[model samples]
Target: MDELSWFRVLNPNSKNPDGHARSYEIVNQNYANKTIAEFTPHISFTNYRACQEYATANLNAGCPGKSVLDYVEEDTLELTDPVAWVNVGFHHTDKDEDQSPMPIHWQKFQIVPRDFFAQKPTITEARSCVNGPTGGAVNSTTRPCIATNTELPTVSTDTEDPTTGTTLTATPGAWNEARTTWNYQYLWFRDGEPITSLDEEGNEVGATGETYVLTAADLGSDITVKVTASRTGYPSGTAESEAVAVSGGAEPEPEPEPEPEPGAVTSKVKASATKVKAGKKPTVTVTVNATGVTPTGKVTVTHKGKLVGSGKLKNGTVKFKLKAFSKKGKYQVAVSYGGSGKVLGSSKTITVKVKKK
Candidate 1:
């Protein structure tokens, strides 16, 4: 629609250019036949009377010198699946003259599909890349939107040993780096349930910050934290860390052990005396240690691949008296530990000197 027409042209000095003086017109259009040009195009879109109520696909039925709208008659309500041609355009003010056909002038227009297909056509483009490629459907050019988790977030804790009365700090996973640009929230869970506790004034409340102190109520319960990440134009995303168990005034127990590995235990063997009289038993002390926890089981002393003495591990250590030696000489004694399900076995050797009696 041109606003500068001779009759209905609007005055830009008094009001904004073509300040929407008229409403748009919707003419009946159809797929069965071609749409004839309007008898006389108007700045205000007024001319034909037949289009007042209906349009026909038959171009042969139109009369000479009559607009397509004039040829069509109104009151045709039986027409199914009616098509509508909506008029849409804007007024472009003319600029200074240009003789050498300046670069193509730009105009605003859109021809988009609406509800023509079961699903949006752009979905095909997004589906092509969502799960990698399939049969060369890769879209190299710009595809429509594909919503997915762009940022990964995870819950982090301050201490590995979760014990009663220990303060635990958690850092919610990251979304956008700037906290002011987006929103983030934290929720603590106990055994899959939201954790709730009392405030200083004895009012009950839920955890909201990055730090939570363990209490007696948390004893022996699995604790986990969920971090929700949010940013403008992105769907909210949440991630949770593996659970951490709180102990009752004791160090938290280690998780179930994987298949045992070799050399998980270290052992030292010591003798009470380096030299002794023949037929005198020597005290052999063996100590075994596993990091951070006491190891249980037994230790055996062997001489020349033969069993000499064996004792059970008590507090990760044990002592055994070697049977008296009949001959006088230096004897190589070997101390070995039969490991437990949690740790591998260990072996070490010591020397014992015996003198003739």
Candidate 2:
């Protein structure tokens, strides 16, 4: 048999037993008799039942004299049971007389390798420590120090400028000083180990600025910053700045814009009224006078606080008719232009009084 060839066994009663009808192939095959190398079989009830029934019925029908019987006995028959008479009623008593034979046969070998075991590495175990902060006098040999759980030591040095009235203070977080060169402004760490990368606080070993403009997204509680400073012609120094608490610094967001007021002026809308019968409709010619602020949107006309009609502003004014306002007392005419999120001009309220016909 190959490494993992599939095979099926005929054992109807064997389904109740473990590995009775399963197919398996040789995995090791290193034994002298190749017994230990043979892989275990996987037994399924359906296959076992069908195969055992077929083999039993064939044996019972006196069909052993045929070539099929010889092949089954030679290839599938167990040494303990020469006749290989499997009790069909072992698991299921209601055996079908018309049960068909399973064409699939159990093979001794397979082509694929067996999958059993594999491991992965964690982040801390995989990272390596690089060169980091060292402590010593200027021009003296400095020993490499691994960043541990302790807070980074502070390095400080100061110089008084005779020309300037200010005394220059240089901490580990300070940048401009008497030093020649610096790796970065701040120190980073992973699992208490000093990292040669920049820290989240922007303080490495030589960082300095009056005000750090950190992004709003980076503002959070427990955020810390370490300062490193160095100056030309002076010994370099490092210092841990006081941690800035973001909890108290957050501010409220601004309010949204309000809706535009009604009766706002857009382009000019000419107004004209004609007298008519009591029941008749009165034509109100609203000639958009001058294109005031040329409205870029739809114009709405209101009469006596009710929206009488609305139309797109074409050539500045739109002509509309009002039936209810034809015969009325006093009518308030208002023209509003502008949609949401936009501001348009507003006209003074126009009053029109209608007399009875």
Candidate 3:
């Protein structure tokens, strides 16, 4: 029998000084190809007592050379049955250390057994029938043959302003997945699109898993969020999760407040005297036509670029008196609706001809 066919034995009793029993085999001397007994001795209360009785009885009954029994003399012996079977043909070794050992090696089978019932199939072989020859055959079966349990991991999105280092919390929606455990091939997305870096060019920066971390740049204005999940095992190509939009982050500043509409006022300034005599006062009137603005402040009159007179407008009109006009051939007169800083309406400039008087 092969090494796999030999059953490993264990000792269970604490009182037993002997440790666990090793693998052992039983073969027929007349028909070396045939196996008589293939089992490991059990060390439990029941099995240990049974093995002890059997070993003692067999050793006393059969001839010492033909019947060989090996056991641990510990308080108790524990053992397990051989889980698998293998073929070890031909040579034999000495049962005790005193005996000269035979050179035991693997020998070819004299004749290959055809569908032998004695040899049992391996665990892997039993499972193979359940899982057909083709890949993913289990999923295609109409009846449920396989059951799976899944545990989804939590995911979060975080963003920080590069300049200010201000942190912003991004709301990470639910990660989508057809099944909890992926088929172990292809990229998986928590939302919709494949998880990628926040760079301008969407690159495959993250690992090929369901969870994804989005940086500040990735959460920019143009970026939209969606979850996608996929794997190779399923025949549906790639399975996708639901799409979820990410929220949070500083919004752009609002447009500047509109400036107040300009005051509706039109003013005209003119000189009454065409020719002005030296040391003579020149009379001037500043008229304004404004629908909204109330003419309340004093009007400033200027002649030849000099402040000659000042007066207040009673009802959108102002008349001013000029004193001691300087000697000149001609001069320009400008009237301001309000005096200096108090200007509210409008201002107009007119030509004034000055003559020697």
Which candidate comes out best when scored by TM-score?
Answer: 1
Q: Write the per-residue lDDT of candidate 3 for residues 1-357, one digit (tens) a residue.
A: 333222222323422112333223332222133343422321112223333334333543332322113433232433443221223335454577544654445443222222222123463321322422433333322321222212222233354232223322222223223232333333433222344454557644743443434445433211222223333332222222222233344544433322334543443443243445443456676665544454455566665554656776676566655644334456666766542222334567766665553
Model 2, residue 148: C-alpha shift (Å): 99
Question: Candidates sorted by lDDT, descending order?
Answer: 1, 3, 2
lDDT of 2: 0.36
What's the TM-score of each model vs. the native? Answer: 0.31, 0.22, 0.23
lDDT of 2 by residue, 1-357 (tens): 323224233434434222344332323222122232111222112212223334223444434423323334345533443222221111123346535753343323233322211111231311211112323323222221212112333322232211112222323433332213444355422111232326788755532433233333323222233445443222344544332323222433323323656754334445665654332345565544433344444555566554554555565566666533323366677756433223443444555555553
Put down candidate 1 lDDT per residue, 69-169, tens digits, no spaces: 54334424443333332333223355666536644654332333222333334655334333323334323233212222233334445567777767766
Residue 248 displacement in candidate 3 (angstroms): 68
Which prediction has the highest lDDT against the true structure?
1
lDDT, each prediction: 0.53, 0.36, 0.38
The positional error of residue 66 in candidate 2, measured at the CA in angstroms, is 99
Better of 1 and 3 by TM-score: 1
Count clashing residue pairs per candidate. Answer: 0, 53, 22
